[model samples]
Target: MSTDRFKDLPIHSYQSIRGDIQTGDLLLCSGSYPVSKIIKKVSKSRFSHVSLIFQWVDRLMILESVESYGVRIVPLSHYFSDYRNSGKPYKGNLYLARHSAVKDLVPNKLNAMLRRGADLTGQPYDIEEIVKILASVVIDDLTSIRNDKYICSEFVQECYKKAGLSFQDDGRGFIYPEHISKDPSVKPLYELIP
Candidate 1:
């Protein structure tokens, strides 16, 4: 929670503290587009997407499942300067976050979690899960998420489970960016906004 180091939202630059970010960190987005607005409205939450971070050699990359690309890895800088190759910053508030349990994980466990992320690359995005998530929220039903496909948040939840870190859903429902954000173990680090 000592995100003060980044000087809060509208961060001067992601590079200033880029070196401080580590694998197992997270990126939460409160997007501005129509689909993002729909997600926020349906879930009654500010954040519409969540991605897991991985430190790959000299670069920090993100593992996220998007409607167009499914599960893929992209340099962290992509969001700051070239989202979707648009030559513009991402269209929303981006918060850096971390899970306290991740720090305690052994290297093998951490690697396993990250390995799962890597293995999931190119997996198809689950549009059905998105509908199910929104429906679960509306009607208050507990639905089990399928393993063959993923929504952004579901992918993150699955990866963390490989490291033996549970968000403690207790089979209550689908995982959402808001649910991860509100978890006691997930600490806010900084916010970078375009």
Candidate 2:
């Protein structure tokens, strides 16, 4: 919770922070995109996006469902660079969160979660579901439209469920980045300022 650890580091330090990211860690982010702005407004939360981290070979990669690229695995470098180019004054304003119960997870369960995320690679981003989510926010309905595709937070929730850790179960698709961030089981690791 201390801002002291969230220093304004150069872009190159993103790689150093990548070393600290573990598989199944959640990368909660605040972005400058239009949809991001709307999500923040609706959720009333600073974070508008979330990605699950996984180790691939020698480096770390993030599995996320982005509107532009859909569900995909990208190197941590790409994730950081995208934020750096966002034109936001506070680029890379991200917080890393790890489930407090992760330490108690067996290796198989962790691997299952990673595999679940990996299985969704190349899936399309659910734009319709996003609209429904936004509409629900406006109406205060909180209903979700289940679909084959995924948005960011729902994908993360599914991965955690596969890993045997279930946090919020407002049915399957009714989740947002704020919901995950607010969960008491998820502990903040570090925040990258600017």
**Candidate with the greatest lDDT versus the true structure:** 1
- List runs of model 2 lying over 4 Å from the truth: 1-12, 82-92, 169-173
lDDT of 1 by residue, 1-194 (tens): 22233244445468888888889999988899888998888867778999999898898899999998999999989999999999999998888888998888899999999999999999999998787766776567658656689989989988999999877552665777777887878888878653
lDDT of 2 by residue, 76-145 (tens): 6665555435633334267787888877888899999989988898888988877877787666765776
lDDT of 1: 0.84
Worst lDDT run of 10 residues, candidate 2, spans: 1-10
Q: Total clashing residue pairs per candidate? A: 0, 0
Model 2 gets an lDDT of: 0.75
For candidate 1, list the clashing residue pairs, or say none: none
